[model samples]
Target: MLNETKDPLPVAERVVGVRLESPLVGAADLIKAQEGRASKAFAMRELPFRDLVNVRGELSDPAFVAAFAGVVGCEPPAAPNTVARSDHYDVLWLGPDEWLVRSLAPVQTGMLEAKLTAVLGDAYAAAVDIGSGNTVVEIEGTRARDVLSRGCPLDLHPRLFKPGQCAQSVYFKASIVLIPTGDDHFEIVVRRSFADYFCRIMVDAAASVAP
Candidate 1:
């Protein structure tokens, strides 16, 4: 007689009607295991599975700005290349009519889209989820600037790139969005396709100094 066997994997769990299982990692993880960390100089890690959305709307429109501030839980930046920061989210100004909204908490993409759409009725705007298409890498430590300057030409001096500043710059060959969150601390947003290449570049740059 044959006996039935049970599955080894744990059943998927859910919270608030959302699936909370099927764990995943970011593109950088593929090389994270093999790379020699520059911890002595700079520490690096991928901030995967974040709530990142592309926002395009007219800031001149009061209704549009109001709708955006409502959902993001913070007001949008009026100046160019600046970030409106809060404990839960950050609104990054990319252009006169474009912005990138990154939420600290993981959220439902569809639900967030729906909420924004509903609030922006008759307003010319769009909220597109790019979480699956890109990821963020945080690098910070004593020698962070040296590692970044290896490929990036931006003047990342503390006097020039203090907290609350963001810019579009190139790293190696990848065009990335750079945000300085604190002294020697930065967040880089890169396309999923270029993530692997950039990770390798980061490892090489970090190797120059020491761990």
Candidate 2:
């Protein structure tokens, strides 16, 4: 509907050409600038506007697992902390019975929710779209692990953490679902409310070692 050409918002809320946003909208630029002041050890940037859905289902129920697998086109991860990827989405395991599904393509709001609901029905499974409630940050550089390990307690060495791994853990003061996407890269999910604080933390760290 954005191409409808009519004002997207009511006339009272309209600004000639301004885009409505949150305080963190421009924080990425500031973080990038701050990273420039560092020693170029690693780099961090925000991955904005990803579709996220929080799912809780009965892992013991075959119907529950099959329902999501049909919609996601991949079986939900049953591991303690793992990730499964399909052509269109990444299903991250947060716990034995909880997972977070993220879409690779930009989708219309409510599309993911409706799609899952249709397949899930009124079963014991539950799915809640949380795309707007969380923000994803990517940290990767020559010494990405070194930089992240400063705040996170996880053992990021290749011997332990590797691709397709995901865990719910603390990063400094904020809680995050840390996903290892590559040997030198990670996707950290922080709550929107903590995004600003999280950005500041990474910026400060990246300043000492940005590349």
Candidate 3:
């Protein structure tokens, strides 16, 4: 049986799409677990073997792409960086001129964005801090894509959604960036304010996908 009520309680803390049948803590309970939450920010359980690096810069510069591509020894395709990696770099394009370079070790975000900006030189790029304004939720387990497909339009097929690939699109009416980490795992980047509402929609969507 499912709740199916207009306002079902949220499970999975900062994450929204938790299965109704699975044990979960309430949103308020999850909030209480974290210490430094005043507003516009919250944290969830750290995802295994993954770290988030947010970078902001003028994505308009042609040289910017070239330098990034140089690191990989091939031209970066006309998409974001989640689909390509060199030893440890997984670039996920966040916007036209912005990208999120992910790796196992945390790097200085400002320094990296600065390096790109300096390389562009007079190309006039600036990197901004978006860590507090967004939430990056990693969706794993074997059935993850099946859960995401209910609300996301982008193809989740492994052939189409290879690792090191990322896309920004609307999920349940809220805009988000989807980064594929594995055949079954995905990283969801969403704004802070809509986290709760988005989680609710995700739970409903996931429940519908449950067998």
Point out where model 2 deviates above 4 Å. 1-23, 32-40
The C-alpha stretches of model 1 lying farther than 4 A from their native spots are 1-31, 34-38
TM-score (C-alpha) between model 2 and the true structure: 0.84
Please say which candidate is ahead in TM-score: 1 or 2.
Answer: 2
Name the weakest run of 10 consecutive residues (lDDT summed) in model 1. Answer: 15-24
User: What's the TM-score of each model vs. the native?
Assistant: 0.82, 0.84, 0.58
TM-score of 1: 0.82
Query: Residue 181, candidate 2: how far off, in angstroms?
Result: 0.7
Error of 2 at 91 (Å): 0.7
TM-score, structure 3 vs. true: 0.58
- How would the candidate models be sorted by TM-score, starting from the highest? 2, 1, 3
Candidate 1 lDDT, 80-150, residue by residue in tens: 88999767789888998988888776665445566777898989998887776777888888888888999
Candidate 2 lDDT, 41-117, residue by residue in tens: 56677676677898889878888888898888898888778889999889999888889998876554346777888
- Which residue pairs come into collision in candidate 2? 38-207, 40-209, 40-210, 41-209, 41-210, 42-209
lDDT tens digits, residue span 1-211, model 3: 2345645566434234434211122343443443233222222232222334454444456775666555433333446444555565566666655666555444432344444445545545444445445555655655567778888888878998877677888787877888776666677777667666666666556555543
